[model samples]
Target chain A: MFVRLSAALLAMAVLATAGSANAQSLTGSGKLLLTGGVSQIEGAAGGGLTPWAVIGGYGSARQIGANVYATDVNTTDFDIRSTGVLIGLYDRVELSYSRQAFNTQDVGTALGLGQNYTINQDTLGIKVKVLGDAVLDQDRWWPQVSVGAQFKKNDKAALVTALGARRGKDTDYYISATKLYLARGILLNGTLRSTRANQYGILGFGGMDDKRHTQFEGSAAWLINRKLAIGAEVRTKPDNLAIAKEGAAFDVFAAYAASKNISLTIAYADLGHVVTRRQTGLYASLQVGF
Target chain B: MTFIALALLLAAAPVPGQPGAATTPVIATDGKLFAEFGGREGLVKIVDDMFVNVDADPRINTFFEPAKREQTKARLVEQFCVVLGGGCTYTGKDMKAAHKNLGIQKADFNALVENLQKAMDKNGVPFSAQNKLLAALAPQHRDVVEKPAY
Candidate 1:
């Protein structure tokens, strides 16, 4: 499955041609490198775990940009994989969709669901840039802010229902703000989210209480150069299920922007209690955009 | 919740006014580097380097051809000095009036920005100081980018 996924992801990356990149400046004028951020797991432009306020792609205000990404996270107890496509319109709006596969490697057998049972989810996201410029306004106190939404649907709805989740589908709303200090080569992003997912919607959303909770996610990165950035991210999760206590997630990561169109991110993530305890892992993602 | 608040606070920490990568200075902190940048010497050097690239820039070279190189350099130094908070005051034409009829498109503006970055890097200007100047100059894009994105 990993091999197949790898092939598909590579094909997506290769499919984006340089000819299709319209502008002479693939990224906007005055925008620093890696300012687009990396593609998040849910297909938003951001850190590995949390979405940032920057719009996805290298498009300036008058141009259009698109992105495609694939991710694989191998942990001690599970293997989580995802692939997605995203498009940024005029550097103001972003639309994204991602498919996630959560493979309960040994845990599936322990739960009597055979070996390597996989839970599939599809997420659709929309974000609109509503505020200041993260890059150009660095001299002032302004931060770029955006409002977004992600609607997620579980493939195996019946199985998720049996696992004590109230629903197999739900929507999450978020508002994120991002600021940059180019002089210091630092970037900061903070997001407020409203969600009720159980283990990131692998087991589904809104467990016993069936209540929505507000959460916070944030990321900070130090830009090493035009092509490299190192950072850390933290994402809060809702605990609504009686079966297991959901814990917050965090990761330490680095991203390399190989070019205007390609980026690779790697992180060490601690997604506490994904049905099991302390699911620490190496998270890797490849993104291609223009 | 406290963690989130803490993280936001950390991120919002005020950016310090440091000179550049050149000094790692403790209280060589007299804002000397910025003052130097504002001085006639540093401003002249920066404009000299910038115009050299402008003459070679394919996208915007023709725009500079009609103007006298030395006059342009002198005016730029004055403008930069004023922007950098130097004691000197600019006597040049207003930004929009000066840039008018130059056919400055976004591509042209972008090319000039790249050239400026190169010049800054070559001048040993600290990255932070360069940004401070750029931030002041960025608003001029509204006046300079006469055409749509190019």
Candidate 2:
């Protein structure tokens, strides 16, 4: 899929330059912003199989100015995914929606239950820019800052109730703050996410008595050049469900912005599970906006 | 004996290299910076990229869409080249004189700057050189850009 997209993009680039006879004379301000990175604050959200930071935000391109993306997360026994889209209004405000699909393994065999289990959830988000430009304002001490929120809703009662869950469907809200500091050549981002969902269980885990989870995520990216970036992210996740005892995860990744239309990212992740295992993967995506 | 030795050592020095360092000639001039930026050819590429950027931008697209791209590009090239001390003559009005009525806002100026940066990056211009050019043009902001740029 990516190969075809790349071919198409290259073709367009060639066609754009083919008619050189009366080439347009130089005019206006000519600038292009490049965007691509490997990890999203250690797994906050990206293009990884599970949806990381790479695909979620209005990336660093100047043309489209704003964008939104969605994808699915597939694991061994079940499939989870998210779909969302965002629009950039006046290059300032962005509104988005993301739906999460939680597919549970067959209940009869895995949990001694009567039937198969599945769940669907949705999260609505909005992000607004409060400060500087991550690309053009290299001289300033301030970084471009944006504040956003996610309102999550879950659907699937029987299975959740059987698992001792509080409510079949509930709302989980979060406030995420992100910034890109260009002068330091480092993009520092942090988010405070407050949610009512259970650790690994999406349907308000631990019943109604469980306190909302407050997580802090931090990520830093070093810009190597206009086209490449390497970064790392550390984030805290809920472990209330006892699905895993891990408190945090860290990931290192490299990203390549092949052009205005294409971007690729790869990362090595450690969720710190039974024996401190390693999860390494690659992500490739194409974004087109006009 | 120490005073005599010190005097002899001081005298042995090469007379302070003719009492002062010779000044080097200024290799770069305002005109040269313009020429080095690919003269008119380079400016043309930048203009093309700028138009593409403006067209893609949703906020300012309406403002630029009505203008003929070719004419706009040609005028901009002449204006910028002349400002940078290039030999070409610009037919456009003075910066402040022309932009006073545009009601250009800060957001519009920022958007334009972003586009310019993109064009420079696409052309593979060194960051230092890009900044040098930008510094030379920074003074125009006072006149070419108006407050409340709608």
Candidate 3:
């Protein structure tokens, strides 16, 4: 029921803004192309791996915007799929919800579980702009900043706890700063995240170490044109699980805005060791919005 | 590793507002960018077309309604020319003075920028070149916009 309602709202936002002759209407799509970053893996508006400071959709100040996205990531031994909906209000506050499914594939059978065992998790997020303008304030050295939090819950509570996870539910907090060098066609973002999620909470939060750790994530992108951008992102992760050792994540991506209402992102992602072996694979995402 | 290299390369690019560089708003000094903008004649056409867009744009048309069209166009052309290193002089009032009491908001400023981008696109200006001009003008928001987005 909630999914249907969110879909209806997203469709309405697109239809209402699309037919308008003037983009400056009260609920108009006035922002420039590609300024609103694409949806991240966890459903925030940003790069494929990390969230940026920009709002989710094209709607500028005094307007409302929303989007729906589907993302898929396939590694040699696993498959991860995520889908979500997001809403940006007056470009000041953003709310989002996403669901992720992690397929363990043959690795599950090796661990005495059935093949293709899946762990499903849901995340709810909110972000508030703190200061500056990432797009319009191109002249200032200071970047736009935002604070956000994501509350997550995994369905496989018993299995994850058996695998040395402390809890199946937790919250991750982060602050992100994003800036665009308009003249040089460059965009840079830095985020500091406090989290205890092991394997992004798929293996559940905090294993032997039950304390949250601060981590850094960064992205640098070059705008090839108005509709196209190529970039790279690096995200540091915590090794809180005693069962597995983890490493930082890295990806190089290309995002293309086919039109005002749709965008596609493709990337080569290296997630380091998931559980047993080093995992690397292809990541793709599709976003549709106002 | 490749991501780090790419990021380093991008960060090493020339930054604006460096202390030693000449304080002028002009980005290019070699006249190459002026040629890319098709020189003074091209600027005239871009300014003219931008006004056409502005007039039809209800969001910001009211702001332009009080100004003299020809005078504003000429001043804009001169300002653009100076920014592009065309060696032109801008004789009009400073951005703060000209926009005083106009009640310009962030949305209105962005509207004008969109119109200008359309004009430049219509005039066949390269996207990167258009951004250079915009980057030079972007700082003027501090003076031109009276109402904050917050």
Candidate 4:
């Protein structure tokens, strides 16, 4: 299914460019460097841990843009790998798809599941820009705002339910606001999300109860120059599962745009407790945009 | 962490159009920003280089021709000089009046900004100083851009 979807998207991209007068100029007058934020873990354009209001890719208001990214997060007891693709339309709307694989290395053996047990989940996301502009409207006090949703489904439905998860599928809805203070070279974003997803939906959704909770995610970045930005993010998660205690996630990251098309992000991430206690390690991602 | 705290502090810091920075477009009362921009002579060179880039840029070149380029450059320099508190008066028309029939879109506006950034880079202007100028000029889009009628 993933292969078919990827092939269809690739065909669409090729056809769109072929139909344009100049294929190379399809993304004409690209956005300012680093304005289109990097891909988030759930595939939205944002910081490492949370989504921002900015769209993904370098396409300006007049063009269609797309990007493909792969992220790897390695912790003390687990390893997570995510890969995704996204498309942005006229700087107004965004659609994304990501596949996450969570490997429970030694923790799986401890829990009697097995060593190196893996849980796979697929996330489909859509975001719309509702108001304001983060970059151009520097004079305004209000930040750019966007509303988005991520629909996630885990492949191991039976396993997740046996582990106290109520469901193997759910949706996370969020609203994000971002502002870039050009003069001070600072970018700030805040997001409010309503969800029942446990461990970002990999371990399934709603273990304790069926009620959704509103959580907060925030990011603060300092733009060192056109190519580099360093930031930190804090994301509050719902402790829905009864088996293991969950806590807030934190990361300090640096993103570097090698050129108009490629960006690299690296971070030290503390995921609190994925399933085991004190899961923290290195997170790195690479993205290519057009 | 300390960085997040500092960022939050700066986020609440006084920006332009506030009491700390003055309400009007004349933001740099200390002449510090103007010096970083190389003053009037520096503005002239920057504007000239910007025009050269605009002329070469196919996306926005249709709005500017060689015949009116010189006059436009002079007006831009004077306007920028005034904005930077270089002690000059803008003799040119207002933003809306000047761009009345140009049919400028957001893309065009951004393209112009990109060209200006390149020109500033060529002049060795510091990034921070360049952003200060951009912040002051960013509000002009409200008057300059005219949405196309569908």
Error of 4 at A83 (Å): 0.8
Best by TM-score: 4
In model 4, the runs with Cα more than 4 Å from the true position are A1-8, A14-26, B1-24, B148-150
Model 4 accuracy (lDDT, Cα): 0.85
Compared with the true structure, model 2 gives a TM-score of 0.56
Write model 1 residue lDDT over B49-129, tens digit each, in one string: 988888887657888755477787788787776656554557777777778887675446656877887788788776667
lDDT of 4 by residue, B121-149 (tens): 99989988998888888777666766534
Q: Candidate 1 residues A230-251, lDDT tens each?
A: 9999999988778877888889
Interface RMSD of 3: 6.6
TM-score of chain A for each candidate? 0.90, 0.65, 0.93, 0.94
**Candidate 1 Cα RMSD (Å):** 7.1
Tens digits of per-residue lDDT, candidate 2, B1-150, equal: 223332443455344224222111122446666765677788889878887888888646765635566877888887667655666767866667766767665346556766776887887666555555554444354455453233
Give the better candidate number (1 or 3) by lDDT: 3
- Per-candidate local distance difference test: 0.76, 0.49, 0.85, 0.85
For model 3, how does the per-residue alpha-carbon lDDT over A1-290 read when each residue is reduced to its tens digit?
Answer: 34773765667566656865774455656677888899998999999989998988877776777888889999989999988888887788888889889999999899888999999999999999867778877666778878899999999999999989999999999888899999999999998888989988999998888988888899999999888999999999998888888888999999999976999999999988899878899999999885
lDDT of 4 by residue, A1-290 (tens): 44754674687578667876867755653577888899999999999999998988777666778888889999999999988888887788888998899999988899888999899999999999867779877776878878899999999989998889999999999888899998898999999898998899998999889898888999999988778999999999999888978999999999999987899999999999777788899999999876
- Lowest-sum lDDT 10-residue window in model 4 chain B: B15-24
> What is candidate 2's CA lDDT for residue A32?
39
